[model samples]
Target: MKFRLLLSLFIFSIQHLISQTIDKEKLLEYYESQRYADAAQYLQSMYPSDTKDTKSLTQMAYCYMMSGKLPEAEKSYLKVNSIEPENVPVLFSLATINSRRGNKAKARAYLSEIIRLDSLNFNAWKQLAGYGENADERLKYLKKANTLNNTDPDVAYDLSMTYRELKQYPQAYEVLKTAIAADPGNFTLQQAQLPVANQLGKYREVVENGEKLLKENTDANVINEMGQAYFYLKDYQRCAALFKTLEDLGVRNEGTLYFMALSYRELKEYDKAEIYAKKTIDEGISNHTSIYYTALGGIYEQKEQFSNALEAYKRGLTFSSSPTLYYRLGLLYDFNLKQAKNAVNYYNLYLKNKPDPEEKDQIEYAKARIAALTTTKELVKK
Candidate 1:
């Protein structure tokens, strides 16, 4: 019996040793070729139980991370950390996982630990300066990162964001300029730069560039930005004119219709506003429900077309689940048609939804109107 046990143990030891003796080079080649699933399977099949096989274990961890097997990656990477406590790359990889999993604070702490270990880690410094931090601190970290890798597009974008947070729009523009100069075909940089220009009230810059781009190759997004810039500058006529041109050019999308409604509403052209608002609905624009309904209802109510106002409010309610629709319905029924019973029903519906706290007093006033109507009905019966 003792001899049989000894033989079994010897065979197990030999098998383990054979697996440990597998080549690291072949595994890495598979990884580099982007065959991550194959690499992971190969690494796992030959995993070494030996304490000194740190490289094999770390490779297994990286393979798991690459293949999106995060739980397995976490376990393997933890093993790598145990073997190589000073491995900055491994720690940064763990930090990235934490960030992707939405644990930003943990990710930041891990990044800070990396910075502590290697003070010149540019990527770590740049990531640590992202949004919701003090602008000065972000700038300091980003500037440090840029010093290490000035030509990095990501670093340039980070520095631009830092400057934007500081409200230093000109500096942000310059940083974007540097980034674009490095990679002129970077559509992302152009998209990011547009918002910074808008934030800085650089309307003329937006209009000029956007208009030139429109002439060369017009796009819906660029045209929307240009329209917003004109709207910001209070150039209602020009804004309408531009959107009209877009409409004529067959860019009569929901967004353009919404903008047209806004422009016409701003100009106090309620009839035009109603036309475009209806167009927005017909085009299935989801976001314009509030203003579209309110504007349309207001236009009809102003014209004393009570039935039309009621229909507009009801249509708006179908698309949106807002209590404001009920409130508007109640007001139109009470004031326009003098349908006190129907008005009371809508007012009660609005009250049930708890519309807004500021409107609480107004709702109480509406309740008084309902009570007065009830008393009038009783008197009429007498």
Candidate 2:
């Protein structure tokens, strides 16, 4: 009886070992096929307390990482690192996990170690660039990545942006030009090239790329950029057309309205210009309220609506002490309304603001008006 019982116990142990081996084989197959959730389930069931199984542990870590179980993945990765210190794959995995977790400092340390282990790791350098404390540090890492693989469009794009952040538009433009030449079909590279070109005052490039982007997508940003380029190039008709399209698309704002007003004004469409100018003031560009009000007054004046122009300029003075507005008020009162006293008051206000050197003609005109108005006032009193 004792011998039979012992034989039964041995048979049971052999069956248990066979089951575990089969389960492990299934787990590995699942992992190899990228079925991480299945692999994780099998690992949890068969090797619940078996950190000694380094292969299983590594597979489980990757499974956890792929499944978005970040904390669990991090714990598993730490355990794997303890067993095989300085494993490059484990280090890279840890870095990626920490980066997703927003632990940038820890991720940077891991990536630094990876680069130290293998200096030619382009991915490590590229990842490190995003963790830099400043633009200079970012440039250093991005430059290394670009040097390692200049043909990589993504690396070139990142390096170009870093150059743009430092206000090095010429360098940024050159980098993007090279990148676009290499990857001509990449629409993102083409779109990015526009802003840098615009900054360099390459309006021709802006117009060309912007038109191409518009064909693919009528994105409001692209439309605004194209419209601005047209405005700068003195193509008011096209500029107004684009801005009107933006308005139809429900993108009316102070900036778009202001540009629209300017475009229509330049094209002698005073009524349309006045509508947009009024909208710009109502929408309120907080820093440039005076400019918008002045524009409204100018629009009204262009329509020969002197009373409205005077009222607009007077209301604008409540918001800003703009010398140009004061000068315009002086002219309106002197020439349009024939009020010498009011003209003298406004002309003196204009002189007080110390107008720019380019305003020498206006300055001389204001002084003469002040003298003439003062003399006329004295003669009327006598």
Clashing pairs in 1: none
Model 1 TM-score (2 dp): 0.56
The residue-by-residue lDDT of candidate 2 on 1-382, one tens digit each, is: 6754553453344334423554444554575577777766666666656555566677678888898888988888899889987899999999999999999999999999999989999999999999999999999999999889876888888889899899999988887788788888888877877778878888988999898888898788888888888999999999999989998999878888899999999999999999989999977747688888899999999999999999999988888789999999999988888778888889999999888879999999999988877777453653
Candidate 1 vs. truth: CA RMSD?
12.1
Report the Cα RMSD per candidate.
12.1, 14.6
What are the per-residue Cα lDDT tens digits for candidate 1 across 262-358?
8999999999999999998888746677668878998998998888988889888877656788878888877777777777788778878777888
Best by lDDT: 2
Candidate 1, after superposition: displacement of residue 4 in Å? 45
| Candidate 2 clashes between residue pairs 3 or more apart in a chain or in different chains | none
The lDDT of each candidate is 0.77, 0.84
Q: Model 1: residues >4 Å from true position, as ranges? A: 1-38, 41-47, 130-151, 158-168, 198-204, 215-217, 227-239, 245-382
Error of 1 at 84 (Å): 2.9
